[model samples]
Target: MSSPQRSMIAKVDSALTRCLCVLIVWLISASIWLLGLLSLSDLTMRIFAYGEGWSDVSWAELSFMVIFAVLLWRHTYYCRYFAIGIWKGMGRLLAFQGTLACMGLVIAVFTVDVEQHLGASVGLLETGADPALELGELGFILLALYLAAPTSVAKRLSHSPVSNVESAHTTAEKEFTV
Candidate 1:
């Protein structure tokens, strides 16, 4: 291929890669947000159930859910940087959220009766709340975690010539200053 053709191809490839990365990040974020919303809805239903009027603990739980929603919203906003090939701690944020979700879902699967706890409320699966649905959600969380892992991010960055160039420039500066 000619030089201009190769350069054009490279630019197109880079754009496509960026778009794919952004799409994946958006999908992961949206999934997690949906899960959180469902949980919040279920909790609200339980709190308002007959003979289960809101209490101090119920208020605390609701507050925590609100905080979680806010944090997730912020993280979603920060995801815009990923389109420009900036990590900006978004990977760490994703890993942390994914790990927490995995642990919470595992515990819920083992200890809580999914149908009983959810109480006719919709769940992540949309069919009904069940251990199998929780497990499916767990699988997704694990996949997100794997994708956001530091090693995985590093590997992806290493393949980018811009990252390599930046690293080399920084190394050269460090060597000259020392």
Candidate 2:
């Protein structure tokens, strides 16, 4: 038999070629657009109002919704051509997205003249002259950023290819042939 070093399984994971990353982002985006966003928003509202409670629904409907959500997210990555910037640390994407979300929340609170009571979100943002923003807005902003992070990473990976040597097996396990 050919050495395990030469086995197809060795490269199967790496063979992903960065496209899978793109695929994941698209999947998430689509999920949010079709099913996740609405369902998640509803879920958030419900939880805030009533906390965790059991829901009785047909299995078929649940299954259909899940499948539809997945498919929608998968397809969305293809819809938009996003230019992801330099590839940095693993968690950088999430961090950047989150920062943007926070900034957006601050901007919204300042621009829109509205009265909102701060329950838990007060700790995160100090209120003096800055109009207080609600927790719901913060939650939605977070959700949006969360969805966009993966796609951003994928765009970066695809645009900037890693050197073959850098990608070569660096796993702990070593192999030997007889």
Candidate 3:
């Protein structure tokens, strides 16, 4: 293939990869949020004996989710596609959020049943609210961060000085060629 053809192909491939990564991350986060909401509802019903107990998730299920997150955390090769390969700084943020999510999941699983107790225990900390709820919330927040990190990095880099310079240079080169 000619140089331009090769570049076009590479750009297409990168775009496809970015789309795949975005879809995967978004879907996973959405699923987790849905499942967590369902699980919370089930637990509430089981404890309070009210409402529909749908989507009750067990400890094993949470463990599986943690495992999946850990695996996803390990596989960050697709991050390069974000912002036309300028999101290298986001790798650490992604890794940290993934780790935080995993930790929150484990804590949530351990205190799944006695969330009130967990809250009481941490009440002295004055952190506000139940510890279990906080942990669960943190997990979801981290997942959101993980989901948004790539796009945020891409956006930030797109307006970066380096990118502006590169864009200007490319435009000049094209004009000269024409």
Candidate 4:
């Protein structure tokens, strides 16, 4: 194919890839938000009742989340598409994003069951006047974030370049022209 054809193909692929990446990014962001909400709910419930210690299981869960965050805290491959091209600025952006993700996880973990800082432990959308409604709020927030992440990303990146779908269509039409 000619260079224009090739450029067209590459740009189309890139645009599609960006759309997919945006989706994936939103998914990750949403998951993080959900986890935070879960922690918030747990914290709220345990507030007024008997003091529940961070048992072996809670600690285990915490440690696991902590470790998982640490493991995923990588930034060396953010802007790299298919591991082929590596731009300095893109790499830096990736690193920054990765770091931000890790930081978000850390913040969530620290405030998981800490009710004082966040007001209530449960959510406030509940029907009745529950003292610790923050948990419910947290759940809603978490769900909202996760669900909204993809939408937000898609909306943000909607202006991304159009892929070869149009070009392919044009090619097909021209092929039938003669």
Best by lDDT: 1
Q: Which one wins on TM-score?
A: 1
| Candidate 1 per-residue lDDT over residues 1-178, each given as its tens digit | 6654468888999999999999998988767655544544454454354555555334434654565566555555445534423354554554455455656777766554665576753444355446455445444443443344333222342367766666777666968877
Residue runs of model 4 more than 4 Å from their true location after superposition: 1-6, 48-178
Query: How far in Å is the alpha carbon of 119 misplaced in model 4?
Result: 41
Q: TM-scores across all candidates?
A: 0.33, 0.25, 0.28, 0.27
| Candidate 3 lDDT for residue 49 | 37
- lDDT for model 1: 0.54
Clashing pairs in 1: none
Q: What is the C-alpha lDDT of each candidate?
A: 0.54, 0.45, 0.53, 0.46
Q: Which residue runs of candidate 1 sit more than 4 Å off their true CA positions?
A: 1-6, 51-99, 106-178
* Best first by TM-score, ranked: 1, 3, 4, 2
> Compared to the true structure, candidate 4 yields what TM-score?
0.27
Each candidate: RMSD? 11.2, 17.5, 15.5, 15.9
Model 3 over residues 56-124: C-alpha lDDT tens digits? 545544554575466445335445544434344344444455555556667766665466655545333
lDDT for model 4, please: 0.46
Q: Which whole-number lDDT from 0 to 100 does residue 28 have in model 2? A: 62
Which portions of model 3 show Cα errors greater than 4 Å? 1-6, 49-104, 108-178
